[model samples]
Each structure stands twice: as structure tokens, then as C-alpha cells.
Target: MKILYAKDFNRVLDFLTINLDGVTLAFSTAENDRSFNRHKDYGINNLNSIVKDFNINNIKYLNQIHSDEVLVYRNDFENITDKEGDALITSEKECAIGVFTADCVPIIIVDDKNKVIAAIHSGWKGTYNSIVTRTLEKMIDEFNIDIVNTKIFIGPHIRQCCYEVSEDLKEKFIDKTNIDRDILFKGRNLSLEECILKDVREFGIKEDNIYSLDLCTHCEEDIKLFSYRKSVGTYGRLFSFAFIK
Candidate 1:
């Protein structure tokens, strides 16, 4: 974890970032007192500070709706506000694509071989509906990205340890995925990371290329992140992004 001080906002920006093959990947962590977000409904307002601190430019992002929608950027960064999607993909250089999340999963897929990258917001709904699956498929088909050459970074989110859900909801996921109910449930808690991994492997991505962090927004004692459940809808959001610059 690294800290970036945004003097303008007086924010102690704690975040993690890594660069691989010209693409930069990052996510913001917050103390319980404040949020990293600023937008109201749908826009890049929330990403302004985070992007600036990272020195990222030509930003492209989405007004995530927790759906399976995936957008392929085509110089339409101007119309991002109208785009209601959970994932954004592009091969454009000097532009960063991103998504916002609290307890939901933030995923960044990088295909350096083909110069394609994706930023995905996968909440329970998006996970159940296979948002990442759709995004990967789009990248493979449209961008001609080779799955084997791609590396995935799973950012901070509510892990099974803190992501307790209704038994009915757990059963619902089992019914939808046909995945062993026992494998997904840890005494009424769910592992979104597991769900995401199943889809990643099914797409032929090797485990060695997939990197996931164990940080949980709800229960992370160190480098705490904003949690929707923990804050009861008053929580701030984390911004996850990736791009070639």
C-alpha cells in the first residue's frame, strides 16, 4: 500500500498501483472517516481526484449499474456519462478506463500482447449475471486478445469473511451457476472472488496470470476501505482502473 497526498482535496490518498507491459492498474483505499467518491448519479466526478493523484489522463469510466453491460471505447470518452455499464475496455493509449465500487469487486484485465485492457465492476448482481465473463468474451472476440497472455488483477472488495448473505441468496447463486453450493458458501457467507475465479478459469486463463488481493473493504483492519454494509449506504466508493500510458 502507498499513500498519495492530494493537497488540493486535503486527502491522504492510500492506494495500490502496478504497471505491467505499459498498462497501469490501481485502486484507492480510504479511512472510515471519508470517501474517495464525489459523483451523484453517473459521471467521472468520483474519479477526478484518484486519477489526478495517479497522474492518469484522458480518463474514461462508466456509471456502473451492476449489469452485464461491457463497453468498447471508441473515442467516445465524451459520452461516458450516458453509458450505463459495469465494464469498460479499450486499446487506446494515453487513456485510462475505470469503474467504482465499495463492497463489490473491482477487476482489471490486461492483454499487453494485443494492447487491450478492461476495468470491471462486479457486484453480486453482476457476478451472478456473469459480467466479467461477458467482458472477457468481448475482448477475445472483438479485440482479438489472447486469454493466455492476459493478466487479471482482482482489487479490494468484501471477501467471504465479511460478505455474509442470505441463505436464499446463496442458494440462488448455486442454482444459477450450478457450482457446488458448498464451495461458494462459508456458513452463510459468500466468496465473490471464488465466483469470479471460476469464470476466469473457464475462459482458459491460467492461474499464474491471475493476481488477487486478500483485502476486504468490510473487515480490513489495516488500510481500511469503504464498505456499503459497514457504512449502511453512507459509505464512500473505491475507484479501480487500468490503461496504457
Candidate 2:
């Protein structure tokens, strides 16, 4: 697997593309010429352009309520509206699944043997609920995926260097994971990435199969990545996509 930062249309837009066997995965950054402010309708054009550029015939996204809800997609499923969930799983080819995030973690999971792919949105609330583990378990139960052969990609997000939480929130993770207080609480903050990785490992995903972009959205001032904590009401979401080719 290789992680690449790419530009298109004469370097007018920037994207993070992950290259894995039989799959092409990507995510847009705030630097893209088109805005991704989902509340306004303008971002739809950018999203459409991306779909066209990637030649994706069908795409599934979510309402993303920060819950652990998982939406499974099949070619036969009728499209009424985008499902309200934090994760999307699909094995169909030519169809892409994506999720939007600013500071939250955007994760992509792929089962190479089964051609199953999943896109997950894990905010602090979702992480506390073990959204990643739930999504993997759903794949195992529904698709009969082998965790040892699956590849997990953790995209750019606010890292521990910049992600600070209140004492109550810190204690919540500690109580839930039973991790040592000193290790869970680093400096004045808790590390969501560490917690999520722990959960993924617990779900039987090999440590070597996991990869992290390690880019901190909030700390990288030079990059035009979105950060809700940094930009507050003005930030737009970054789009993360995954599909089987």
C-alpha cells in the first residue's frame, strides 16, 4: 500500500490518494478549488466533478449522525436517500463509498480477498462507542471477511498533539478501556487515534496491516485541510472516498 498526495486540473485542487491492490481510495482537502460546505448546495458540484473525474458510476454517502450505525450497500439496494449512518460497507464494483469529516477520523477498510470496502467516520463520540470495531465486526458477520487479510487506512485528522479533551472526557476513555490513566492521558489530553487503533487491534486486525497518514489537520497550518476545532463555524468538510475497482 502507498499513500500519495496528488493534484489535478493543473494543481488547482489537492487530494490524498491511497493505492492498494484492486482498489483506489482518495480524499479531498480544503485546498480544492471547489468548496465542500455541505450545508450550502455549491459543494455538490465539486462532489459531482470528483465523481466524474474518478469515473465512479454509483456513490454512497451518509447523513453521519456520529452514531455507530452501519449501512451495507449492494447493487440491488434501491437508492431512496443517503442513509443516516457513520459507516458504509460495500462489495460492488464501480460503486464508491465516502464520508465527510473536518476533525474527525475518516477510516477506510478493505478486504482484498472478498473485494469488500468500508468507509467510516469516527468522531470522538463515535470512537467512544467503538465505531471502528463495530464496522469490522459487521463485515466479518455479513461478508465473512478475514481480518488478517484486511487493510485498514486511517486518514488525516486532528492528532494527539492538538487534540485535547476535558477531564470528564479523558476519564470516560480510561474507564471504558481500562487503560492505565497515565498512558491514556498524555499531557493534558487523550489520544483518540491510539484508542481507535487499540480497538482495531482487539478486533483481530493485524498491526502490520494498519496504516495511518499521521497528518494532523489542526496542526498543519500550511495545508488547507479543514478543522472544525480550528475554523469553527467557517470550516467545510473534507471528503474521503473508497471503492473496489
* Model 1 misplacement above 4 A: 1-13, 31-34, 38-46
Please identify model 2 stretches exceeding 4 Å from their true place: 1-13
TM-score, one value per model:
0.88, 0.91
Model 1 agreement with the true structure over 25-95: per-residue lDDT tens digits: 77777753434453653334546655566676677777778899999997756797578999999998878
Clashes of each: 0, 0
- lDDT for each candidate structure: 0.80, 0.81
Clash list (residue pairs), candidate 2: none
lDDT score of residue 145 within candidate 2: 95
lDDT of 2 by residue, 59-82 (tens): 777788999998898887766135
Identify the candidate with maximal TM-score: 2
Worst 10 residues of 1 by lDDT: 1-10
Best-fitting candidate, measured by lDDT?
A: 2
